[model samples]
Target: MQSFDPKLDRRRFLIAGAAAAVAVPAIAQDGLIDEPAAGTDPDVVHNISSFRARDWRPHFSSLSGGAILVDTGSRALHFWSSDSSTYRLYPTSVPVSEELTRRGRTEVVRKVVGPSWAPTPSMKKRNPEWPDFVPPGPNNPLGTHALYLGWQYYRIHGTHDTRKIGRPSSNGCIGLYNEHIAQLYELVSPGCQVLLI
Candidate 1:
């Protein structure tokens, strides 16, 4: 089995994009690094703000069947293996506004590779110009993999748009890098526990 290390992998990911990186100082007590208020230019969104490793105990009773804790404020996801061995931390894109965010526990109800996409009813109502459906491909918003949550229209999925990572960009779902989500897809199973906070 391939091992995962949050520190080492995070360093590698940062080094690969060092040219475009900005200084990241620690932020407020809430654990979320403050960013420019909502509605700022998407291009200006920071690739990563606060990336921190967390103990799964506070969020989960145990790691049986594995556990995933998504810190929406920090724009990061933490995963722990069922045996409490492997752990991974990945920067993620969160819901754009408080109204779009959902907190509490859910389980991965399904896992799909090369998943298709369709905007939710709320999404369509807000933006009627979007297509009714999009086949699995480069243009699909769900990217290469998706972990369908117990909640309707919610997923922990990947995005082709790298700029969305570490920013509040998704309509409601949590977004990860295509590569990260692909790796996560391999490690997680359908009944894996998930918490969004």
Candidate 2:
């Protein structure tokens, strides 16, 4: 199996452009970094602000590595060990019990860094008072990490709303927890396979 390292080689990562290239700091390492042990540090959870992507999604090979499939229809998220197989299944934080949770298909097109939160016209139509670009803060609706969805004007981003996880809350975007999105930001590169089935 190919090793997946957080501190992966920058040269090994294929990005869309210079902007995306600088979003995450790809560290160099030989073997995959052991995942943070459960209860490693209550005070040391990696914040979403850690590795932000701006505009890169060319490194991920759709046929390789792990694939994360999120289905809003059932309010569920599934992780495939590999494209050719399925065994490892990880559920999301909350039950996708809201209407905002939905399902569709999209490829990993572009990733962002400290991404600007631009409310969609639809979002603005629903919430005329919503701000354009949410400040890059812990409480920002965009949360800490963000992986821009191929969907037009849509994104799968981190959220400060732990209570909203798995619940349909977004106008049309997929919501991820602060840490999970940050971890994903570190692990996957641009173009990493993503299907919102």
Candidate 3:
């Protein structure tokens, strides 16, 4: 057998390794690699209010009335109530949690009247002053009613602080004014599709 050239062999090996390193991510980006699901971190506080959705009009005609669509960027939640392109637009607020705010398709998992608030572990960790639980009442963070999302720890709920509506101030949950949430609670039911974008 011919003598092996160490330098040439090493160079070839390095080039092949570099090519694979580049190709691996490309394959993964194309959905070749199985990745783990991402987790959400709860926020510490929710006291904020400023912007609001002022105009309400038929913006899109594609979605069917009765679907709930949330625009995170604008902090607006729309409930299509009729087939005639008209929809109820409510100013809403989302949590500072970016991952939880990511675009995804999920349905209303549960509906509750006068729901209580239970601080998530992460939330409590962030805010040591937060109580372990909050009872349902005028001061309840859940407000009058709550529409829980399929994802854990996320919901479209009413807030005692109506000012927070239209502000970015939650731990990943969506907040609507008490009256607005009451109307939404009546209009929606379990299994209603919720699109968060």
Q: Pick the candidate with the highest TM-score.
A: 1
What tens digits encode model 1's per-residue C-alpha lDDT throughout 1-197? 97999999999988877744433333333445345458864323243344655667767888999999998988889899999989998999999999999999999999999999999999999999999999999999999999999999999999999999989999999999999999999999989999998
Candidate 2 lDDT at 102 equals: 46
The prediction achieving the highest lDDT against the true structure is: 1
TM-scores, all candidates, are 0.76, 0.56, 0.64
Task: Looking at model 2, report the run of 10 residues with the lowest lDDT sum.
Answer: 50-59
Q: Write the per-residue lDDT of candidate 3 for residues 70-123, one digit (tens) a residue.
A: 878778886765453545778898877685465677878899999998898878
- For model 3, the stretches where C-alpha displacement exceeds 4 angstroms are 1-65, 82-86, 97-100
Clashes of each: 0, 11, 1
Residues 94-113, model 2: lDDT tens digits:
32335444455565667665
**What residue runs in model 1 are displaced by over 4 Å at the alpha carbon?**
1-49
Clashes counted in candidate 2 amount to: 11
lDDT of each: 0.89, 0.57, 0.75
